[model samples]
Target: MSGDPVAGVTAKTFGQLPDGREVELYLLVNANGLEMTVMSYGGTIVSLKVPDAQGNAEDVVLGFDSLEDYLSPAYRSANPYFGAIIGRYGNRIAGGQFEIDGTAYQVPTNDGENSLHGGDRGFDQRLWQVSAVDAKDGVGVVLSLVSEDGDQGYPGQLETQVRYTLTNDNALDIRYQATTNETTPINLTQHSYFNLEGEGGVEGQSGILDHILTLNAEAFTPVDEGLIPTGEIRSVEGTAFDFREPTPVGSRIDGDDQQLQRGKGYDHNFVLADNASDAKNGSDAEGLVLAARVEAPQSGRIMEVYTTEPGVQFYSGNFLDGSLVGKAGQPYEHRSGLALETQHFPDSPNQPDFPSTLLSAGETYKSHTRYEFSTR
Candidate 1:
């Protein structure tokens, strides 16, 4: 089962989807031989075994071992956001519709009459075809998916390619690239939650509200109960939203603010530095600066997120309850896990003030978000 950890890793099937369709899982062994598994289902990174400061390697993300784990309601091996490659449009569209060029497209409303994560059939639930599994590029497998112009209620036929590359330095680099044949909106991203201790579910793990975080932004978008933007980018000063420095998440989480209740916790979008464009043009500007830093003091593991995207969504996992057991035999509970999803602001298609998440013909939509790991 320890397929050459230092060379081209192999592909295998852990189980079959309920539809009797075969799902492929690719294991990318870094030059250092560390192992990271990627499943065609949702293009999810099921497991990533890497060495920590103690030289001990563990699976650092939340997930299950079987396809049934994802489809079954028993273990809750599902992550509405874990390691899934989301969307022609990633976040919510208020009222399940958005306008483009004087015309409106009626999208599917799966979340309280609003479209959430590209609706019930978002990219998270699809099985993409593998394009490249070159042990040569340290990319055990490159998964590609083509979204029909009208698939999932979005416009434009988009050819999307996501490359998951594991490095010898303990970094899982995700590169997203896409090009549309028609004028359409695009906001693609990977929804991977990091627990650092290699456990899933929110149980066993302590609160990350105390985890120090640093974001390079002064403003953020507040949301309503549906977690949809209210068309305002408020400043983080004197509020719990500020992460300009490494601060405790619990410090202001309980603020009686309306946005807090809307998110049920800390589900808000931070407006990253305007330099996101400079970085996209491949200029020398610091495009992917330190967006956030999290430390599991007890475990001595530190995680830093960097990206060229315009905003980062800091979710405290306010909804997770101890009902689901993780791979390491731990039940995940509320606030036990934290997700720092980097991307453009949610509800961008409707928010005229937020940065554009649109893509035109002949223009390539490229986004790169890096999760760097190290010791205290």
Candidate 2:
């Protein structure tokens, strides 16, 4: 809170863990007064204040007000992922098993028969070292973490770094970089549930069903009963999965499609059509392609997602059944928030047709995704 309003970054103590480890919260404010708060604990994005058409600012992301709430048993059981960073493997790995160089490996399975978002205690549950950094056209913080070999049952000593920058043009740019001592699968993503209309609403009726969404994807990877991909990259044409145009999120969410039934909503990975090989490193802004766009008509807020990743997972907050209350002191009802996680496809290790997420020794993994905000 000690930085100037015209693009600055400041750090303050958020809270201390039960083990006496202190967590720091960094505030990054852009020139337009758009603010983002990130905490060292889990490298989580605590809050994002964005302005509506009327220039009124409000937090557009769903999260808890205090650290104790995040540590509660109920919260841990729900594992909504909130606004934390997912690593090792962002999405699911079938049966928590995979093979590399003919050597077999098995990770903890927390999601039914599949492994989800790393193990139970993934990057989202660990503390990161955070430092303020001066971005080219923004102010931000860099969070770094090192996972030892056999940590979370993954092979290799992985060194990872994530940068969150709030640019002057009201864009939150996220860049991920990692290097491993041995060959392993690495897919990282930011899991921030966004409502655009703000966190909680009247009588806990907040949901994202009214938001209009458009995905630059012609196909999607359908899932099985366990929500794991079926290895078939089916076309979305003439199906409920089609979002090529601006369509309401709830338009066909309740259809009789089996994919919708398995996911219970729009929780599928869309294969981006604008995949450019030159953009793999995400070093140049021109290399990024438009992935998805979400608009909240009620608030006149729009969020356009751009990324270099091959796929984007659109989760409509299916499991939030009013069991947990957010910072606004209101229960988070079903579909109260949504997540657009840009990364490689799910179960990539098992599906050879999907984009490869393998990171070999002496090679660095890089990815970038940007969320640009504006009013239509």
lDDT of each: 0.75, 0.89
Residue lDDT tens for model 1, 11-79: 888678778888988877777767888888889888877566786777777777777777776533344
Error of 2 at 218 (Å): 0.1
TM-score of each: 0.91, 0.96
Query: Quick one: best TM-score, which candidate?
Result: 2
Which sections of candidate 1 miss by over 4 Å? 1-4, 74-79, 133-137, 200-207, 274-286
Tell me how far candidate 1 lies from the true structure as C-alpha RMSD in angstroms: 3.0
Clashing pairs in 2: none
Q: Please provide, for model 2 over 261-364, each residue's C-alpha lDDT reduced to its tens digit, 9 standing for 90 to 100.
A: 89999889999998723323223334588999999988889999999888999999999999999988878889999999998899999988787888888788
Model number with the top lDDT? 2
Residue 119, model 2, lDDT = 90
Error of 2 at 122 (Å): 0.3
For residue 168, model 2's alpha carbon misses the true position, in angstroms, by: 0.2
